[model samples]
Target chain A: MPVITQRLRVTARLTELARVRQFVHGCALREGLPERETFACELAADEAFVNIVVHAYGGESDGPVFVRCRGVANGLLISFVDEGMAWDPTPPSAPPWESTETEITVGGLGRLIIHRAMDGVRFTRRGNRNILSMCKFRPGFSPAE
Target chain B: MEVKITEYKRVAVVQPVGRVDSNTSAEFEAELRRLVESGRTNLVLDLSKIDFLSSAGLRVIVSTMKSTRKNGGNVCVAAANARAAEVMKLAGLDSVIDMHPSREAAVASF
Candidate 1:
């Protein structure tokens, strides 16, 4: 399969969130990803993008966010790059679907959804930019869940 | 978010259409809360029309549920698609509130 990568740069604003989802949805569909898988990627990407706007840029609309969609074997990778405040590269550890027996709160759910929706997620800080990447694979082809 | 609220005898069904994200969650939350303040506390949130559910919207759902419950009211959700349902589950919000498959069922649950 041919590997293709696409990129988009948008201002860090809540209003830009839909455009970001549309960009990724179009790319994921063109890659022939199933609707469910495509939606999962969209949700994961939205969570990451929102975090960039809300946390990285502190809800400011002036900062820039770089979004990328890359095609890989049996899956796709969605990544975000932002020059907002430097954040530690720790992926959230929201418990899996079964063992979560804690009280539900309104806050801190954005990262939890991102960590759970995608097959794998990674974070890194390079120079002054914070990078987050989420990977999702087609069913039956996904490795080890 | 475009909200369509149908008030029943005891409960009201509030169906919000379109994406409920950071940009529109405030309006959505306001609409839901308005119904409560207007003496309609028991509510059924019909999510059949919501295309996307974000954390901002989830927070509104949670806070609304918490607030209403504290006031002897309750919120039930209806017609959430697979992905939306999964998002609620991931947030651990689904287990706390009532969930039904259809708007009528949810309203009748009151």
Candidate 2:
């Protein structure tokens, strides 16, 4: 298969999440990914994008968040770039799903979902930009060299 | 996202059609919070029409659940699609929140 690449730049705002999902979904379909894998890819990308829009910019910055999607080999690679604050690699662990306590707690689930749904996640800060790259590989398929 | 609220045996069945992500979760939370504030503590969220679920959406659900339980009521999810179910499971929400296979069962639980 041929390599496919797409890029989108949107304001780091909560309202722009739909556009992000649309962009990712289009890319996933173009890559011919399975339904399950496409959903996983979109979820992972959504989590990462939300983190950037909500946390990276503190919901105040008017900077732009750049997203890039690439279809390579038998997998999809998605990256988010932002000029907002760098994310702390040490995210708080997600609470167990089956806690015996009656009270339910919120937070940290985004990181958990992203890490679990995607095959690989990498975060790095270069100069003033924070780059988060996530990958989703099809089952029983390896990326072509 | 389109949210449809129906009452069954005093249980508020909140159905959100479409993706519940950051873009639409504010409205989703607002609608649910309104129900909770109106003394409607029992809620059954029908997830059958929800094609996508994100942490932002989960936050709203968790907050509502906490609020409802404080008033001797609880929230249950019913008929979530496979993608939604997988997301809920990965977040461990499936355990924290009661999930039923059907709306009738979910409403009955509350």
Docking quality tier of model 2: medium
List model 2 lDDT by residue over A1-145, tens digit each.
Answer: 5666799999887677778988998899888898988888888888888788767887736799999999987588999999998875444565544444433343367877888888888999999999998898878865563
Off by more than 4 A, model 2: A96-107, A141-145
* Model 1, TM vs. native: 0.91
| Candidate 1, residue A115: how far the Cα is off, in Å | 0.5
Output the lDDT of residue A17, model 2: 77
* Model 2 CA lDDT for position A72: 86
DockQ of each: 0.45, 0.52
TM-scores of chain B alone in all candidate structures, in the order given = 0.95, 0.97
Over the stretch A1-145, how does candidate 1's per-residue lDDT look in tens digits? 6678999999998778889999999988988899988888888888788778778887767899999999887788899999998654344465232323323333257788777778888998889999898888877884855
> Which numbered prediction scores highest in TM-score against the true structure?
1
